[model samples]
Target: MEEKIKDVLDAYTFQTTRVCRGRGAFICDTDQGMKIVKAYHRSPQRLEFEQLVKYTIRDRGYYYVDQLLPNKEGQYLNNNKDGQMYTVRDWFEGRECDVKNAADVLAAVRQLAVLHMLMRRCDLSEDRVEQFSFQDTRQIFLKRRKELRAIYSYIRQKKQWNDFEKLYMQLYSDCMQEADAALSELNQFDFDGLRKKALDERTLCHGDFNYHQVILNRKYTAVVNFDKMHYDIQVKDLYQFLRKVLEKNNWDSSLGTMIMDTYLSVRTLSEEERRVLYAMLTFPEKFWKISNRYYNSRKSWISSVNYDKLCRFKKTEGQRQDFLNIFKYAFIF
Candidate 1:
């Protein structure tokens, strides 16, 4: 850890005596102030891309985020040493919104709506904007299903598992199969057809909007992590936000419906958008599969932890079935 920090800021003075460690980086509280130092194991591409996205969002009139500072060479805190990519950002002092009430949820949605409006009107060039095309999302789902099947097969063949372990293995198998069937139907969807529908209904999307990504201060909402920002179906973002809310509450379908209704009141969805909502419903699962693959691979610490949390979250078969039932009812209508 010391070696990594030195690689980025060799001569930088330290002010504080405390350092906090996270999965990806270290938070140093020194005399120089609070700085978040993130080190990537191999690829700097993602780190560099995230810095650029942060800059773009900040420059485009969103004042909620702390600005990314450049180094002496005018580079955005991206320095590679010993095959590791290191970067730093000024740490802002704030707490995550507990979001305990409907008002908190509604306020967050309103901020997201405002963000979508800004993203739609910004005259940014195509290269500057990053979007997840429908095809790309579908491929992610396919890859995930393959990986989950492999894990389930391995567990089944081991033949030494306990009853709970066996039950979970079967549960995951059934869930993946059900998700695959839903995604298979979604894959047949024509992007060209969706694009036409989108032109009439499209809006700028946060690509990965949810409670975790949103930081609320006393007066304003600050959205971080623009790496997933794209020009895909706007409902994709809304669907993810709702899904997170439901998942956090142990698959409370009533809460999900209330949140969706509140959002719809502010930004009405067209009939065509309603049809595409089914496709959007499956997108989160697509991401879930990607996460599962990373976990199953057991390559990185962060991925492993995420995968464990995901498995734990989806442990209850009855809860997952309830979610699916609600999903089918909401979108298949």
Candidate 2:
């Protein structure tokens, strides 16, 4: 596999004596600094769209994103063996953001604010916008609710319950109660209107803004892996980043406030936007994940440890609620 990919790399005009695998891609030390290569199946049109987005971002004076390198043919994509398409980008010399670090968490929040503003300025055509616009928050919530109901009964019917199942049914019974309240709170507003506003803003979110996507260079922070970049409410990135960090921090209120304040300093969160953000934060995403994975798994038996780990969310329920209560009034009251 390395040799084949190396052959593809050789096609590039750059001379490369060595090729080695790193993480999900290859890291090649080239005359033009170090470059990272990744191969995946993507539509030519999508690649073209990505190129324009990259150019706009770079042109707008935001140069932190990884630069995509064209192949020897002067094209952004290379069709190699197995019909795999490959593209290389300058490797970023930085460390992934440590969510546990308050400084790193706050820095990423500030970066997200700046990115949201920059993405709002990108001018994409109607056709290009239509291709990747996934405004399905309502449908997603509805689907999760359905899954929860099914999973609830599936667990209840088990004759002999394991410790994990018994605990899941116990604590998650309260966790299950949250779903209705959150949804009811959500139903009080015109969510569609907020969605339309987000669409009109033409905002782009990192889509996946976890710790790995955050890169901390000497004095600069860079974000990578834009494969899922899409147009939506700018706050989507904030909500996504905050949820992950809050979980890691055991929903520490002070840390969350500092992170939120950092972002608010850059991008003022309006009342309506705050409401939307609150809705996103309150949704039981982890609940859906546990249910979906358990229901989907076909293995006759599973590790008790794994099931126990899943039940650990129960212990953290207080922390999650406390986290939400800290900012609930920003939207609710």
Q: Which candidate is the best by TM-score?
A: 2
152-226, model 1: which lDDT tens digit per residue?
Answer: 666668748644345446457556666676576665657446654444443356777887667666777777655
All candidates' TM-scores?
0.66, 0.93
Candidate 1 structure lDDT: 0.59
In candidate 2 the C-alpha lDDT for residue 222 amounts to 90
> What's the TM for model 1?
0.66
Off by over 4 Å in 1: 1-35, 40-60, 78-85, 99-106, 121-135, 152-161, 172-177, 184-189, 195-208, 228-231, 266-332
Clashes of each: 4, 0
Q: How many backbone clashes does candidate 2 have?
A: 0
Q: What are the RMSD figures for all models against the true structure?
A: 5.9, 2.0
Cα error, residue 72 of model 1, in Å, equals 4.7
- Please report, in order, the local distance difference test score of every candidate based on alpha carbons: 0.59, 0.77
Model 2, range 15-107, lDDT digits (tens) per residue?
765667877888787777777788857788877777778888888999888778887778878666677878888777778899889988888
